[model samples]
Target: MKYVMVFFFLVLSILSCRKNKKDLINNKIIYNELIREAKQFYRLNDYSKAADKYEKAFKLIGGINNTKDGYNAARSFVLAGDNEKSFNCLFELTKSELNYDSYDYIISDTIFKPLHRSTLWNNLISKIKDNKEKNEKNYDKLLVALFDTIFNEDQKYRKSIDSIKNKFGMYSPQLKKHWETIHRRDSINWKKVKMILDEYGWLGKDKIGKQGNNTLFLVLQHADIDSQIKYLPMMKNAVRKGNAKPTHLALLEDRVSIKLKNKQIYGSQLMSKPDGSYYVLPIINPENVDRRRAEIGLNNMADYLSNWNMTWSVSQHLKMIDSIERKKNDIDFK
Candidate 1:
């Protein structure tokens, strides 16, 4: 009777642990879904809805301590013209445990432009500067300058493309002229980036901070394929050493591979057919692609592809690849 009781208690304990784990997973899924919806609203320029969703997500994830989420909520609120909510969120972020080193983003980010004229913004900036960690580096000013230059150029490029699209649709002959101008500007910027790389190798997080490193990654993404290939090893090493993110390396590697007509190891890049259907560019091992992606902190292929208005299924991808291979074999035999 004693043995049976002990066994029953142990079973109950195991079931309790499983239930807790399942609940945590479900919570994380819901949290991510909320974030995705917020981002979608932001992309659609529905700033008020985006701000509310972001704040709701932050609250759902134990509000006060989640500094990153709080900061995001604040930014979105500012964009939405909600000064009260924005100030509240920003204050919470400043008080949170996370050591946000850079105040430059608060000053320079366009979303915060509305807040700049307010006394609250000045006081908040003063408070953050006073409470900043003693050992924090001050490279953010330089980093912000670099980011501003890149951002302005990118905005111009995007606006030109959008104008052409809005006026004449996706495949207008007029797009050729706009693209040529964009490409020329991009090449000039790429030259500047190359000079920066020569002076400061790859700008890892240690040197310039995460935001700066992200800006560098954006520049690299816009660079010619050869430049991306040239820096692939350096970026990969940074990722391995935990100085950089795996996602950037994965994207660069996949892009370079696709350009070379070789199978990509991580399926980050996609191709669009003339019929508007999108497919994963040839990957080395489609069977375990999601596993590799998950290991690198990426979403599953299906969820990631959905951002581009594409649907993905592992089984369908496998079948498609198999059919392509069979067709190739038949042609070779003939």
Candidate 2:
């Protein structure tokens, strides 16, 4: 009777371990698959579906406290025009370890444009402010002022560019003059940014906070390719440490790569042909591009290309490039 009882207990323990291992594997698979699907939907601009999938991913991975998926779900909900769901996701985020710095993202991102006029938005901001310490609030105020200054300058630059485009048409001969003016203004802004970075050292998430970092990123996005390359390593490290979004870093990398005539790892930027057709800028490993993009939380290349009115097929693109290369060879041989 003693042996029988011991044997039964051993069997139960073995079965429990097996079950636990299986459950862990299943959970990991589901979490990864959900994130991939959500990114696909996001690339297709199906914000509602993206939000749903992200929420599911969050639940599977232990919710807002475990991952930043809830914040992404919130942004997607806003983009989908579901302010209520967006607010709910934000509320969930508030329960997590999110700090006053997250409030900066909530206020600065254009994704939350739909929620700006809502009472819920106001309440959330007020709640965040009230929860912060006095020193944090003062720092936040300073950050907000800097953000406002940069944002206003950006708005003016954009307005001027649009006015020029409207008056001269998109490809006008006189557009060069406007470009010169824009470049001059950009140079001045770049100088200001350099001074800030000299004092702040990249305006990292821990220093000036996320909003400040985002504002600096915006400035860098408009700067010359050399400037982007100089900061690329720091930005990459920040993304790896979860201090910055991978998508932003990917986009910047792609942009700089395109300018340098190098193959981009993430196909975030597109180029228009002379005939008005668009194609993704050169990609490094064209075959496994989507897989690489997925690893970094970006969407599938096909759907992302579709946004620029381009159809993506690896085989087809390869064939086209081959033909173009052959033609060039023929001309050179002659």
Candidate 3:
């Protein structure tokens, strides 16, 4: 019995070593195949298939550095609507001992946009943003990288936390209010709110005020309670002065696509705080779930003002745009 046990152990060890060797050889062959196929798949627009092969290749060979094969594999994942996977590939590649330009494709490509929604993507982005925050890079370099992700993911809070990190410290109340509206199924105009805040940190007095029935407030009003309270001593410096609205506007349009694609709309709205301070919030768009319903009345509400019935079809789809425009006009009225 003792002899049999010893023989069994010896055979098992031998098998294990052989298996490891076979795996290593198999990996080499698969890695070469991946390189060949990834390029072909990408050129043929078979992104999904290419992505699958890339993932398998990565599993077998681990990460390869400074090679078009790995880079193109990441690109295929992005084109395939799997940004998380693309990000993983790039992340692994970036960590390789070999140095390569991962940013090469990002500069000329739009494929990386979808990954802006991923948490992993945001974490990596912060590393990049950190460099900029320290003044090691220019605004164009930093902002473009930041904006690309947020814009592609439609800047939905559910998609990524970066947007929250970007503005929450400054606009807590507004951010909370926007979140509440989403919960209550009230009009949601966060996309527009983001634009206003991004361009002008806090809305100056000219952009907001108290009126008879409706009070006007800028992005500052939505600031987080802590920041609002914290900045009280430096109240005068809270607002940002710039014409960054145009850039925000461009991004806002893309965010609104999530709403417009479903043909949703909203009306003028206002929010109030315990301090008697009132704010007019931007419009809310429809949820992605509602947008995808094949039936019109499956979840339709009679009270809801759809795009076909609105003053402008585009307005129906963009509550954030409408709300900001309303606030803009209100500023003119004052």
Q: Which candidate gets the maximum TM-score versus the true structure?
A: 1
**Please, what is the whole-model Cα lDDT of each candidate in the order they appear?**
0.74, 0.72, 0.47
**Candidate 1: which pairs clash?**
none
Q: Order of candidates by lDDT, top first?
A: 1, 2, 3
Clashing pairs in 2: none
lDDT of 1 by residue, 1-334 (tens): 9999999999999999999999878877887778777777765678899887887777676774566667777777888889889998787767647655456556666667788788998888976765443323555557556755765664466555755765775666787778887787778777877787778777766666565677677777778988888877888877878767888878887888888878888888887676545688767778898899998888888768766656777778778778888998999999
- Candidate 1 or 3, higher TM-score? 1
Judge candidate 1 against the unseen true structure and give its global Cα lDDT, from 0 to 1: 0.74
Better of 1 and 2 by lDDT: 1
TM-scores, all models, native as reference: 0.73, 0.61, 0.30
Query: Rank order by TM-score, top first?
Result: 1, 2, 3
lDDT string, candidate 2, 148-265, tens digits: 4665565455655545655776667666677776677677777787777666555555555555667677777888888888878877876777666878888888899889977788
Query: lDDT tens digits, residues 1-334, model 3?
Result: 9999999999999999999999888877667666556656765678998888877777676555445566677789889887776776666554425333223224335457677666876575554344334432223443344333433323234333324524563247766766664433212333444454557454432333111001112222333344334433233343224322322222223234223432222222234555434332333443442342223223222212221121224334456556667987999999
Give the Å shift of residue 128 in candidate 2: 3.3
State the weakest 10-residue window (summed lDDT) of model 2. 131-140
lDDT for 88 in candidate 1 is: 87
In order, how many clashes per candidate?
A: 0, 0, 8
